[model samples]
Target chain A: MRLWRWIVCLMPGLLSAGEWSGYAELQGRYFPQDAAYENQSDHLISLAFQPEYYQRWDKGNQSLLVVPFFRWDSEDKERTHADIRELIWTYAGNRWEAQAGIGKVFWGVTEALHLVDTINQTDLVENPDGEQKLGQPLIKLSLERDWGILDFYTLIGFRERTFPGEEGRLRSHPPVDQDHAEYESDREERHLDFALRWSHYIGDWDIGLAHFNGTSRDPLFIPRISNRGEIKLMPYYEQMRQTSLDLQATKGDWLWKLEAIHRSIDSGSYNAATGGFEYTLVGIADTDMDLGLLGEYLYDDRGDEATTPFQNDIFVGFRLTANDVDGSELLAGVIKDMDESSWMFNLEASRRIGSDWKTSAQIRLWSDIAEQDPLYSMRRDDYAELTLTRFF
Target chain B: MKLSLILATLLLTPAVTLAMTAEERGLEIAKEVDSRDTGFHDFKASMTMLLKNRHGEESLRDMRNQTLEVEGDGDKTLVVFDEPRDVKGTALLSFSHKVGDDDQWLYLPALKRVKRIASRNKSGPFMGSEFAYEDISSQEVEKYTYKFIEESEHDGIASYLVERYPVDPNSGYTRQQMWVDKARYIPIKIDYYDRKNVLLKTLVFRGYQQYLDQYWRADEMFMENHQTGKSTLLTWKQYDFRSGLTDADFNKNSLKRAR
Candidate 1:
């Protein structure tokens, strides 16, 4: 922690031409369904702010970045929190580059599920799309060549996943006991993780292979009896070894993507895959607009016993871009289970208002959720959200 | 292919004996333009884009652009956005080809992933501005077939009018007419026609400056959408040519590090 303080103290003078940029957002959510948790409200408001500073020295290709984010919820106590999203130093050489400190890295190509993207801990409280992640502390080096890009990582200070508070809509029936979460690795939260990836592009195809060792980002749960006679889910993180592959083939207006992973945890070894394609129709109806159609298949080897939500399911979505000066766009999708005919529908629309302002509307719904589903408790949390963001 | 045909025609009908059609003369003018601006190698510049609605509402964006000249093929370009906090640190890498489809990719900093954009989207607006991907692309002579329209005076300046049709089937414009300055041989103004043969937009180039005593560039470009009552103004800054850039600097991996 001393090193973090030292970097932050000196971050303001990293370069002469550095810049500061970020955004502040205000959101209002409305739930039409009955309250899924006690004392939960149908209407809620949230405020978030993120501040960032970046500096890049032209000499030796050195750079520094610092980003701190915080969220404040009106009702949920646990939902309000603060985090340092990024604080990294980077240096680029003629052939190799190195980066150290807290940052984020992503890997995967599929849309429905991210099978191989597990570098950073999931920031589950951020949104329903599962796209936001917390900063991870690590040291990384990469070598660039004609063959491919080879990268090595030394990960440290593992972060635990965050969940919605008990008073939030997306919470599980029995609150997840994060404070008492246990770890299978003897090193606990200080576990030292290691990872590597080799990526290359050949003609129209981009492929990557990766491997990771140490603690798994996802946790396994056990039902424990509390002192109040209430059942709570005890979160447990196990030592894990994961190997994965991601690929994308771009040809004309069609893009085919695939992500597959095989991992071994405390219970056993499992395999999962997500494959999909995106086809776009440009200038639809003689208007300067684009419509993208997406289809994907997600499968888990655990079948009915799988803890993951996506198992033998189909995901279909469409992305419409108005291509106007305001950058208006709409994305809607549905995930349907093959066996039970259960489903979840989502819609997200956003557009720029002026130079520095943006507005968005979001919707989430569930229907006919079966008991066999891993997240069946969230069926009653159907809600919609509206947000306005100001950029600087 | 057009070059070979021009050569064959030149051999059959002697240039000294005349009999050069407008097509041949138009090809000659294009060749001249290419000849004069051939060896820039690579260049980088800062750009400011201003978007204005018909009501005079304005918005601005800051960006950095770099381009590398390929020997026998089309140019490679990279654009990194620095302003507008929502899109800050977003970079676009484009490899323009002489024939068929060009390759393009977008790097989203927040997502930390590089996505290959559909080439068919080249005709769509770029970043919600009046300039489409095709409009901003490095205009190589091979991408268009040209016909000499007439010699005329445009904007009180002597210019040669020419009509060109995009070779790419996915281009949004059915045809375009350009007025090239007689003195500089650089395009000074352009008129675009939509797919339905309706006038869609007009682009004007101003503040022409020469660099390295060999290359001509415009410091300001304004594009107006006639049907939508929208317009965009792009001001070029810090135009530095031949900065020792290579193909290695324009690859997909470099996009993530562009910031």
Candidate 2:
């Protein structure tokens, strides 16, 4: 409480010196069905605040940005957490830029899945979409030339992915025991990582090629019997190397995107790809609204044996943009398993309330999940969430 | 004396016919407008857009724009949003071309991703304003076929009226009528006709200022839709030219760094 008071007092003075902006959000989630796990709440409320401070010096070539995020969840203790999303310093030169400290970088072009965006760890407790990320400590250098833009990264400290608690609504029957985590590398969590990427655009085609060697961000779970006569799933992180390619071509009203990755581990190697296209019809029905039709196919060579559930799946989505003063938008998508009859449906809608406020609604549902499917554990955890955010 | 006068008249007629045609004259005027504003290497400006609905309700949007001039091609532009707090750090990068479609990319700050978007929707409203994407994009002489209509006076200023037809099939307008300031070679007013050859909108530019003693820019632009009764008022401020901006400042990396 004292620390919070001190921060509140210092915020005004800091704003007078630099540029400051952020958002505070109130979120409510409703689960109309019963929880899949024991002790899980049917309804929950959460609050989050993210504040960002930025300052530029040396003729806008050098700058510092700091963002801190905090969230409080009513029922899920693991969901209540704090993180420094970004605290980075950047310097730009004639044809090169260097950045250091904690940051986030995204590298994929597909919509359904992000196969090549491996820079940051996923904050899974935040959302099921996997769009939220935890900042990663890194030192990055980028060089721009006639050929292309090349970036080199040295990732230092590593952060493990967050999972829901036992009492969390969206959890497996047997919760993961993060305390008993194992690592394939001798350095464990301290293992350093390196990555490089080259990206460029020619005509309407944009291409990116990247490589990463590091401790895998995705962990495999191993069921173990505890000494207390309890069964728990222990996470095991392996060392892996990945090569990925992302490509996009924009032609008239059509945008084509493709992302593919080949990851190699001590055990073996596997390949996965997600490719899709979005075709838009502008000024539909004699109005200002635009409709976009999207279709993407997700494939994993390992098929049902893959760790992720996206093996042999097809995703189809529709996006509507009102192009109105309120910036109204909506997206509905469904992912269907080709091997099984499992399906996951998602709907997201958002609109600006006023100049400084916004409201968004999201609904996620899983239906007819097969017992052997990885998503079968929480098939009954279908829920809808609404969030209202105020920015300052 | 009558024979000599006839000979002289015949010779003068040929000279007048060879001087220039209407299409050539219009093209020359368009070139003049483009050339007069050529030497401004780069510029930065803050802009505000006021959108008025048919019911008289208004919404405001603020953004900052930076443009870099390319010698042979169209200009490179970067627009960063500021007022819409939800999209505060979002930025758009465009590389306008003299022919074909322009290349555009949008950067989302929350996801830290740059997405290449289709630029074929030139007729769609820009930021839900009455202005379309083509209405505000960089104008190049090659995009339209021109014909000089008449020399007239608009708002007490001597101007040249020109009718230009769009060359692109995707353009929403069949043709546009423009009134170019005779002295400054800058467009003072424009009337847009829809694909069906109906009057769609009228745009008026005001508050012209000279920069570098060679370039003229409008501080305010008003666009009104004739059928919808909705309007958009665009006001620009802090126009700084020759700010030492380079090509590197208009790339994908630059889009992410725009704040």
| Candidate 1 docking DockQ | 0.62
RMSD of each: 4.1, 4.8
Best by TM-score: 2
lDDT of 2 at A98: 93
lDDT of 1 by residue, A1-392 (tens): 99999677556555366788889999999989998678777778999999888887655377888999999998777778888889998877776788999989999888878889988998888876678899999999988889989989999889988888778778777887756778998889899999999988876888999999988998888889877787888889999999999999998899999999999887989999999999999878878788999999999998887888888999999999998777789999999998775899999999988778999999999888887777688888888999999998
Q: Report, to 2 decimal places, the DockQ of model 2.
A: 0.79
> Which residue window of length 10 is worst by lDDT in model 2 chain A?
A9-18
lDDT of 2 by residue, A43-72 (tens): 999999999999876677877899999999
Which residue pairs clash within candidate 2? none
Model 1, position A117: C-alpha lDDT score: 91
Error of 1 at B152 (Å): 2.9
**DockQ scores of the candidates:** 0.62, 0.79
lDDT tens readout by residue for model 2, B1-259? 9999999999898687458788887888899999998889999999999999899998989999999988899889999999889989899999999999999999999999999999999999988899999999999899999999999999999999999998989898999999999999999999999988999999999999999888898999999999899999999999999998998998888898998
